[model samples]
Target: MRQVKHLLADKGSVVHSVSPAAPVIDAIRMMAEHHVGALIVMDGQRLAGIVSERDYARKVVLKGRSSSATPIAEIMTTEVVTVSPEDSVDHCMRLCTERRVRHLPVVDADRVGGVLSIGDLVKAVISEQTEQIEQLQRYIAG
Candidate 1:
């Protein structure tokens, strides 16, 4: 199976993040601009939390909170689950499934490397499977 590093190399390590001090609306706007469902809430060099559209819906809309007034820190998921570059794609899949999180930030030596969505992992797994199937078929024919 491919490692997280390989995935990052293909996808590029562009981490779109927002400051925890920013308002929820700012985070939402940033997400829209980036065409991403979530944004890593960074406090300087620290990974403060993660804010997603789901977080906005559940914490702000459902709770009747004002997005413009609410800070990202208030709604963002602070107990983030992170992975290293060396971690396997399978490991990331398991973590996303068990933790019920859509995003996993890749950390290397306490620094943010990149963010992987569940879609990224699924796509990588499918590609790997497809390649394996083709190899098997070629071997069987020969």
Candidate 2:
């Protein structure tokens, strides 16, 4: 099974984050500009929470909350699920499904490595399956 490290290697460990004190509008802007669904809320290099487009749509829009006035801390999901570099891709796939989370911040040795989206896990799984299928075909052909 492939590991989170493998995915990160292909995707290039890049984590886009915002301060917890930043406005919801800023977070939204960052997400839009970066073409991401979520942002890791940081409190001076520490993971504070995660703010997603869903959070914005549900918490701020539905609730009629002011995006410019609201802080990320207000709507961010605090109890974030995290993964490590060495963790298996299979585990991450399970976590995303069971936890109903779209993004997981990758942490390694007390440092933030990157963020893994559900897409990344799915791609990794597909790639691994393809490799296995190719190997099987090669053996049968021999």
TM-score of each: 0.98, 0.97
Query: Against the hidden true structure, what lDDT does model 2 obtain?
Result: 0.94
RMSD of 1: 0.6
Positional deviation of residue 65's Cα in model 2 after best superposition, in angstroms: 1.0
The lDDT for every candidate, in the order shown, is: 0.96, 0.94
* Best-performing candidate as measured by TM-score: 1
TM-score of 1: 0.98
Candidate 2 per-residue C-alpha lDDT over 16-133 given as tens digits, one digit per residue, 9 for 90 to 100:
9999989999999999999999999989978999999999999999999999999999999999999999999999989999999999999988788999999888888888899999
Question: Model 1, residue 61: displacement in angstroms?
Answer: 0.5
How do the residues 7-113 of candidate 1 rate in per-residue lDDT, one tens digit apiece? 99999999999999899999899899999999999999999989999999999999999999999999999999999999999999999999999999999999999
Which sections of candidate 1 miss by over 4 Å? none
**What are the clash counts of all predictions, listed in order?**
0, 0
